[model samples]
Structures are given as C-alpha cells and as structure tokens.
Target: MKKPLPAAIAGAVLAYCALATPTALAQPEAASAMEEMIITAIREDRKSRGATGLDLSVYETPQSLSIINAQTMQDFGLTNINTLLKMATGVNVDPTETDRTTYSARGFDITSMHIDGVGMPFGNLIVGDIDTVIYENVEIIRGSNGLITGLGNPSGTINYVRKRPTNALASSIKLTGGSWDNQRAEVDVSVPLTESGSWAARAVLAYQDADGWLDHYSNNRQVAYVVVDGQLTDTVTLAAGYTHQDNNSDGVLWGAVPALYNDGTAIDYNVSTSTAMDWTYWDTQSDELFAELGWQISDHWLLTTSARQIDYQDNSEIFYVYANTGVGLDAATGLGLLGYPGKYADERDSLVLDASLSGRFNAWGQQHQLQFGVSSARSESEGLSYAAQSGFDVMPPFPGWNGREVPRPAFAAPIVSAEQDIDLDRIYGSLLLALTDNLNLILGASAVDYTNDGVSYGVPTSASEDGTNPYIGFTWEVLDGLNAYGSYSDIYQPQYVLGEDLNPLGSAEGKSYELGLKKAFANNTLLTLALFRTEQSNLEEFKAYGDGDGIDDTDYSDDFDYSLYRGIDVESEGVEIELAGQITGELRLQAGYTHLSLEDENGDEARTFIPRNTLKLLMTWQPQALPKLAMGLSTRWQDDIYFDSAYGRIQQDNYVVVGGYASYAITEGLSVSLNVDNAFDEEYFSSVKYEQVYYAAPRSVNVSASWAF
Candidate 1:
C-alpha cells in the first residue's frame, strides 16, 4: 500500500501553519479598525441555513460541516453543482456518462438532498444538472444525518439556500464569454413592493450556450426564478417562489471508447475524441413551486411550515458502445461491430411537506434549546424505452471516425419498461442542553415510514419498512476559544431488491462515530480536526443459479432464479482537517485535507473512485496598494486509484490541478473579471470504468463583466 500523506501535502501544511500562527495568536485589542471591519464582514458571511433549521456555527457543531458562500462561488466561477462538489472537502464527483453524475463521500454515494432545510430526493440523470445561480450558498454536512434526513445514506447531506428578496432595491447584470464557444448572460433584480418595505419581490434569469471540446457536442441551458415575500402581520411572514429550468444537449456520449484493441494492445486517443453520433441527443426540463409560512410565537419560540412540488422530464436517444476483451475494435480497419441504439423517455412528480417548532427555555437552572418536526414526501415516476432488434452498425471507428458519416438506425415502438412510486413520512425531535457553561449535550431521534412500489421489465415488486434512528453528542469548551466534541449516529435505508424466496431483502443499516476539536481565532478564522469511522451491514448482493438447483453452468434467465442477499459489510475510517475564514484583512483562505480507508468483508478496498488522500486549497488576496483589485488561486490534489477491468487492472496516477482568477473594480458600480482553469494543462482521466473512460477538461479561460446598482 502507498503512503497516505505525500511530501507535497506536508509542505503545504508547513506553509499554512507558518502564515497563520502569528495571526492566530494576536490580541483582539491590538487590531486596527480596518481589520475589525473585515472581521465583522467575515462573521456576517458565516451565518448559514439558520432560518429554516440547524442554526449552529461550524465551531459549535459537533459533526463535520463545510460552507461555500456566494462570494467564493463568484471568485472561483463555480457555475454548476458538479464544480461545487469538486471543491467541497471530502467529496468526490463520479461522472458515469455525459448526462449522469454521482457524488460520493466517506466511501458511499450520497442520496440525501435538501433545499432550505426541506428534504428532497436526488437521483436519475438530472441530479447534477441543477444550476447554482439561484442559490445564496451551499452547506455540506459530512456524516450520518438520519436524525434530520430520515431513511437516508450515511455518507452525508447537502443543503442549498435560495437567494431571498432584499429589503432594499438591488439589481445586477453580467455577461460572460469563454473557450469552446461558451457564452452566458445573467440578470438579477430585487425590489421592495410596499413603501414600508414590508413586502418584497425578486427575479433571476440566466441563459447559456456552449460547445464542447469533443467532436459534435454542444449544449444550451436556460433558467428563470421568481419569489415574493410578505409580512402578513406583526408576527407572521409568508414566502412563495417558483423556478424553471430547461437543458438540451446534442451528441451526448452514452459510453466512452474502448481502452484496448482486439490484439491486446492499448489504444490511445486524443483528448477531444468522441464516440457519439451527431443524431444522438438528451434533453431535460424541470419546474418547481414552493411556499413557506413562519410565526414568531415569542422572543425565543418560532414555528415554520414549508411545502414544495416538482415536475421533471427527460427524453433521450443514445448510441451505446460495449467492448469485450478479445473482440474489441479492429486495429487495421478502425471499425467496431458492437453498438446499441436506444430511445428513452421518463417523467417524475414529487411533493414534500414539512413543519417544525423550535424554541429555547430555562430548565434545571440551565439554558436549553429544543426542536420537533414532521415531514412527508411522495414521488412517482414512469419511463418508456425502445431499442433496435439487432443492434449492430457498420461504420468507421476509432482514429478516423466521424459522427456525421454514421446513418441513424431504426428502433421498435416504445414500451413501458419501468414505473415506480415511493412515499416517506418522518417525525423527529432534538434537544440541546447546557449542562454547564462549559459543557453541552445534544440528543436527537427520528422515526421514519417508507414504502416503494415498482415494476421493471414486466416484474412487479413492492416493499414497506419502518425504522427509528437515534443520535447523541457532547461538546465541551476546552479553552476560551476552543471546543472538543464527539458524536454517535446511526442510519437505516430500505432495500427494494428481492431474495430467492421472492421476499424483499433486509434493510441496510450503518453507524458512525466521530470526535473532533475546533478552534476560533480573533480574526474570525475557524480550524477543525476530526477522526471518524463508519460501519455498514446487510448490503445487498446478487447471485444467479441454474434451474433453481444452485448450478452455475446454465446462463438462461428463465432457468435461473436470480436473487439478492444481505451479506455484504463495508467499513470506512478516516481523518479530516480544515481551516477557513479571513487570515488577514487583505487575505481570505479555505483549505482542507482528508485521508480515508475503505474495506469490505474480505478486507479488499471498496469504492475505487473515492481517493484515499485528497487536498483542496483556495486563497484570495486584495493588496493594500491595490485595493480596487483582487486575485485568487485554487488547487486540488488526489491520490492514485485503481479499478478492475476485463483486460487487467486499470490504474490512474495522482494529479494536481491549479486555477487562478482576478477581478478589477473599474468603477464604483462596474467590474471586470477573468478566470483560468487547468493553468498547467495537465491531462488526466476524469472517470474510468471497466468498459469506458472519460477524460478531464483541458486548459480553459473565461472573461466576464458585471454592473451593480
């Protein structure tokens, strides 16, 4: 096994400590007025996802949490959720195909998502396609969040907060142009509807058209959002909002090209190589409506209720490739005889309702905070698929292939291949007790009811399960500005697969243990170090037999009673360290390092896509001599990973990517910015599977101008 920490990361740690130690030891009284003002600004920026729920600071929270504010998003040019996940600590983005992306944390894929603290399910091909322009900030909680997210994975939870209406009139407009014929425009405006400023409204619009580096690949996207906020009475408030998004893409690849030839020789292709036909396309449309009501019962008591409805649709026509070891593409002719052309259409509808009451009270001569909430979510989806009878095409392949020359194939009529309905209801309660001025205890529990009904390929199945999860933690003030904490949490997720007896498989369960230390400095900087371990059991594994007699020779589906069993067990252990906030009045920084080890029952490494060692750093500086100009740098480094393939084991070497950005305030209300990614132009594979591989983007640059009023 390779060493977990490399020399490059060690050097970075030394540099960070040298730069931060002096400021960390400085006295608050010795700071200048400008420094004090900057500290205040940092404090304001630290407030997150507090209005709806989980109103706690990073230093005060027992679990690991990271926040990416709007300012960081603009500085780094993180326009989409995928880019944001790449920058977040301990998170990995795995690209399965051109239109499908999955996120993993702590060796497990993340399935729990929330908008403004309301639970939302994330799945299918459209999960990563959501635009980030409408969000004010994003919060990532890394651990078992079952106490709040009920019937979810142990990997973690993601919460997005929407940009709300401003009390005062504000507006902004931006125009951008980048490499690959990328052009984008955005407009945001907020106004006070009433003279007294009791009512307000806001609107945001954005559009983008971009051409990819690969041959015959392009995309267009549009988004529109509007919201209204009103203070109905002296102690009551209401908000309503709607969002719509449409995305269309041409020449989307279903799978990457073959990695090896028929003669057992590795094939090397250019970075812009593509295997998609010009006629292939994928399109998605989504619409959402939400409303919230809040009542301030007293100075320390509040009640909130929220509801959301979503409708999503996806339509696609794709040409997929499958390359077997001994029958790969011909080396001399540059042609392959394996292809599958298909058409699919899917639609989903979802509705969610949530209500909570939170308050603080005096009990047993101590201060305590308590919260209770109930939520219900329902979703239904239907899909149709069509495929060619004999999926084989004669066309130029590999080095000399052009998508335009391949003729489109004919497909049969569409059939209902899959339909599903899922419903979940949960009730949860939490209490924070201040045992003393220096000691605190947290207690939480959730009861969840889940049901799933689905039909796949003419096979019908249904499952219903109920479970309760519990959580406990303690935080002690070790020093004047430092805290020590530990927590224990568990999660449960129902499985829909059936066993040989045709009964639903047992549910999967997991437990997490975490301990950490957090420190807050006078400059508003936060430092955190944590150790964690998660154990999962009752994972589903499938097995096939011949004639229902447990023989392995027969390969016919009709003769076999293929079934799933709950026997797999997985464990992941790791350490994480993070430092964030303003290091100085002119400099702002965010840096994180993570080390993970994942293993299954056989003690073999699991989840190869998740690197064992990862580091992420971002820094911004505004020189005193050039107050009107700001510059920043960001970098990410990860360890090597390997996956099993038909030919052999495939290994991807470790790599480091660096990016930079600069912005100049030309005038009071106008500014210009430039961003450059992959400054070193290092080539690496973004994703790799047994049959396909996706390459990362090359060097790219973008320039933008914005005006605010």
Candidate 2:
C-alpha cells in the first residue's frame, strides 16, 4: 500500500525540524557560520547571462529561470545531467531509447543547448550521457530564447557552466558503493602553476562499473577532463580545456516488451524483466577541445572569443521484436518470434566559433549597455548499418525471454546508410536602456542563415533557409524588492522533412509571450510567478500509407521524399510558481509547481505523454549541535497522463516519489554520505508510446565517502 501524500510530507518535515532545532539552539556561534555557508551554497552572487545576453540578476530577468548549483548536486548525488534535470522545475524527461533521452518544457520538446553561451548540436542524445562532475552549475530558461540561439525550438534553453581553475591548490577524492553491485571512484585536483597566481591547472577523473536490476544488464564508464588558465598580460587572459568520455553497456534493450497480447489483454511483467538478449551491446565515446580568449579594451568595454571542436561515436548491436495486434507468445513454451537482428555504427563531428564585444555608455543623461556578437557552427554525421541476411529466419525464438537463451546471429557487410551535414551562421545584437531609476527596457535581434545537405543510399538532398528574429522585454520595479516584467520573443527553425511537392518543408516560425512577477527577500530567498504562451505554425507531420505501397514510403533508404508532411499549428500555455534559497540560518529550500495545457489546430491534445500538473520540493537542514551532520529530503509528484496505444487509449495514474540523503563529517577533511531514492517504492511507468512502455526504477540506496586536502 502507498502512503498518503499529505501525511507523508508532514511527517517528514516535522521529523527533520525536530532533529535540527534543539542542536541549533545550543550553539549560537557555530550556527552563525553555518547559516552563512548554507546561504552561499544555495544562492549565486556572480552575474550571469540572461535572455538579453547581458549579466543580470534573477529577480530582474523577464523570463522564467532556474539555477542548480554544485552544492545541491552533491547533496543529492546527481552524477549525470539526466539526474540533475529530473529535479528542475517545469521539466519532463521522455526516454525514447535506452541510450537516448529527451526533455520537454511547457508541452514542447526542448532542443536548444549551450555550454558557456556557445551552441551545442544534438543535445537530446549528448545531455543524457554527459557526466556532471565537470560542471559548476546549470541554468535553464523556460521560454523562447531565439534572439541569442538563432534558429531553435520555442520550448526553452539549457546552459551548462563549467568549473574554472582556482589559483590555490585544492584536491578531493571520493569512493562510492551502492545497490546492484554498483561501484564508482572519482578525483578532482586544481593547482597554481605560478607563485603570483597568474597561471592555474585543473583535472578531473572518474570511473564506474555497475550492474542493473534487469537480468544480464551491466554498464561501465570512464571519463577524463583537464583545463588550464593563464594570465598572459595585465589586460589579457587565455583558457583551454580537453575532455574525453567512454561508455559501454551489455544487454541493452532496443525497446520495451509488448504491452498487450493479441486479444487486447494486458500482459503483466515484473519491473526487473527485460527483453534484451545477452549478446546485445551499445557503446559510445566522445572527445572535445575548447579554447577561449578575453581582452579588456577599456573600463567599460570588453571583447571575448571562443572556439570548440567535438567528436562523438556510437556503435550498437541488438535484437528487435516487431510486436503487433496478431503477435502473441506460444501458450506451450512461452516463446515469441524474433523480428530482426541489427548492427549499427555512427560518427559525428562539430566545430563552433564565436566572438562578442560589450560596452556601456552614457546617452541623454542616462546609462545604456550594448552587446554584439557573431557565431558560426558546422556539424557532420555519417552512419552504416547491417542486418542479418535472413532476418527472422536465422534467429531463434525466445524461450521464456530471460535474455540469456538466445544465440548471436551472423550479419552481412554493412552499407553506407546515412550521411548529413548542417551549417549555421548568425549575427546578433542587444541593447539595454535605462528609462528611469526603476524601469529598464531590453531589445535584441538576430539574423540567421542555415543550410542542410545530405546523401543516403545513392540519393542526394539539400536545403537552405534564412530568417530574422526579434526580442523585446521590460522590467519595472513595482516596489522595494518586487518587480513586474513581460517579454515577447520570436523563433524560427528549418524543417528537414519533405512536403507533398517533394521539396523540404518550409521553415517553422513561432512567438512566445511571457509575463511574470519576481520578489527578492532580504533573507536571500527568491519567489517567482510566471504565465507564458507559445505558438508555432507550419510545423511538419509525417503521413504514411496504410500499406507500404506509396512512393513516399517505399524508398526506406533514401533521405528525400521519405515522408509527406501535413501542416500543423501547435500552441502551448502554462503557469509556473517557484521558490528557492535559504529560509533560515540552518535550513535551505527549493520548491516549484506547474500547470500546462497544449493543443493543435483541430483542438486535439498534443504530447499527451507529458503530465499537466507537476510539483517538486527539496529541503536541507543543518544542526548546530550536530554541526558536522546535514540532512536532505525531496518529493516529486505528477498528474495522470493519457496517450494512444496499439491496443487502445491508456491512462496512467498519478504517482509520488520520495528521496532522502544524509551526510556526516568525520573530521575536518573527511565525510560520509548516504542517499536513498524512491523511498516509498512507488510503481509507475517512466515512458510510454503506441507500441512500448518502460517501467520506472524501484528503490535503491547509495553510500559514499570523500576526503579533501
């Protein structure tokens, strides 16, 4: 039986407070220092890039924003970007494949990503696999940011900030062990290269090997990162870094097992069940090199230049099942027929360059700021695929489907299956004008040009498009610590699908409207309320024939004319409320609630897999008496979701998940921590589609110890 939500929340809060109050009251001096440290951990003091590409405060930004700091990441043991995103406000994860995960905000799929303000391509796949150890913080903007991103989705954008080298020597090492034979070790070190602190270097390394709850599944990973910073002169600085990551997994599932039998009857399976064969495997590797240069031209003017190159590769072999209405397991043997055995390999490379100049001046007795920048990016991808010559004929039928009975099959020579290239160029500018002491206006625009060229199975295709987007916003100080703001931003994206005329679908365009109120308390806490709407027209939708007999559907290997598009108009609207920062000297909290609605031109709900109502709450407490101990708790809830499946429409019920963590300091430089996830062991589906459903992970425990010097 599940615990009642309200009762569970109340019990946890009361217990935590009871454990912290007495100890805190006994020691006032230690409590004062702890309060200051807690406040610093939860709040950011440095200026950061906002919607207008200017350094701004969270209370002054016109768009909805959320920042997750390094302290919170460590408290929850968030090792990857996927784990970090699960706790963010108004964000939902959609796991399409075992290795691919996508995020959605406000009913729209989020596709834009940045690292230090530079754009990154193929974010959906990269973000899920990247480790979080190298990042200092993550910033999310929950509305359109097309002025800076150029061509992008209207959903939102994510920016990852890396940790920089410190002039002083610092080092930390950690070891972890957890449920399911999981083991991990990591090390981080920073050192000063010069006595005057003019040069510095930093390095990070991590390794992990884990066994999954599912039978025959296991994972192995390794990562290495290094960075160097040099003060070349009094007014110039240079920084460079390199990162490499490799991951390998055995018994990776291509898709989930069938949800229903042939007669539309549900099939019950344990959460630990898997359909993958023992020989199935997936591997990925990535390498990146980046450099940045900064120059202080004058007191009010500065220039920055940056460049990056990335190489990524993926290889996989898997067995597939094409379950349909008539497919069913054998009654006598409980065995099902196999569909196909496939082998795949893919490689991608990207190069990006950016330069920007910002300055401030006085005009008409008022101060103003302006920034201008230009950016160019190019990406290329290639892939090869091979399948068993006899398809299902050479594959053995599943025997009870335990993932260990099937034998590997022979495959034919791989053929060049896919090749693609994309290039983007943009120039953008923004201006901030101070109309009055309490009123500020932001204006920005960008001109973008993009091209896509590809070849597949001896066929060639290409497309080119250009567009201009504008942004306007204002923030008014309504009171001493409260502000009112509104913004309108435009978006454009080139579609890759072909239309009825055999040419590529035209570019999709959209606009976002946002209005919000923000308040900053003297106690270092922030509260925000936001209302937003986004609309897109000329969106592409695929049209397939009932039988694979149409010309557009017959040529499966060609890149062009593979699908006919019917126009689509989509609208997504939502309201969000958030609170974050220190609530008291020894307590820190972050909470958010969101309500969303989405529809298409025909008034039909779109992206039905995403929930309409979601809530998240996280809190941490430190006791003065037990000054060496810190405790944390978090809760997440989501409303019911309805989506269509092959059998029929399926409605998933609402669910709640709880997590807790505690850390104890053994000495000045040594600490130990324990983390428990899904404490109530809630049962639910993490992702669903017409043909497959993935079950959520059950309860798990992890414990780690760290030492710093």
lDDT of each: 0.74, 0.73
When summed lDDT is taken over every stretch of 10 residues in candidate 2, the lowest stretch is 14-23
Candidate 1 per-residue lDDT over residues 1-709, each given as its tens digit: 1111222321121100000111122233422432332222222232433311344567878888888887898888888888788888888887767778777778776777778777665341243267888988898888878776775466777888788777679999989999999899989999978775567788999999999877788989999999886656554556778899999989988867666666656678888877888999989998888777666565566676777778888999878665522455677866654555778898877877777777678999997878788888877888888756643554456765687655677788988877778888999888889999989898888899887887655556577789998888888998998999998888697765665555567688988888999999968799999999999987654443223344443112222223444457899999999999999999999899999999998999876767999999889999999999999999999999866565555567899989989999999989999999989998877775334676778899999999999
- TM-score of candidate 1 versus the correct structure, residues matched by position: 0.88
| Cand. 2 TM to true fold | 0.88
Off by over 4 Å in 1: 1-53, 122-128, 262-265, 324-326, 329-337, 389-391, 394-396, 495-506, 540-567
Itemize residue pairs with steric clashes in candidate 1. none
The C-alpha stretches of model 2 lying farther than 4 A from their native spots are: 1-48, 126-128, 325-338, 390-399, 458-461, 496-503, 540-567
Q: Any idea how many clashes model 1 has?
A: 0
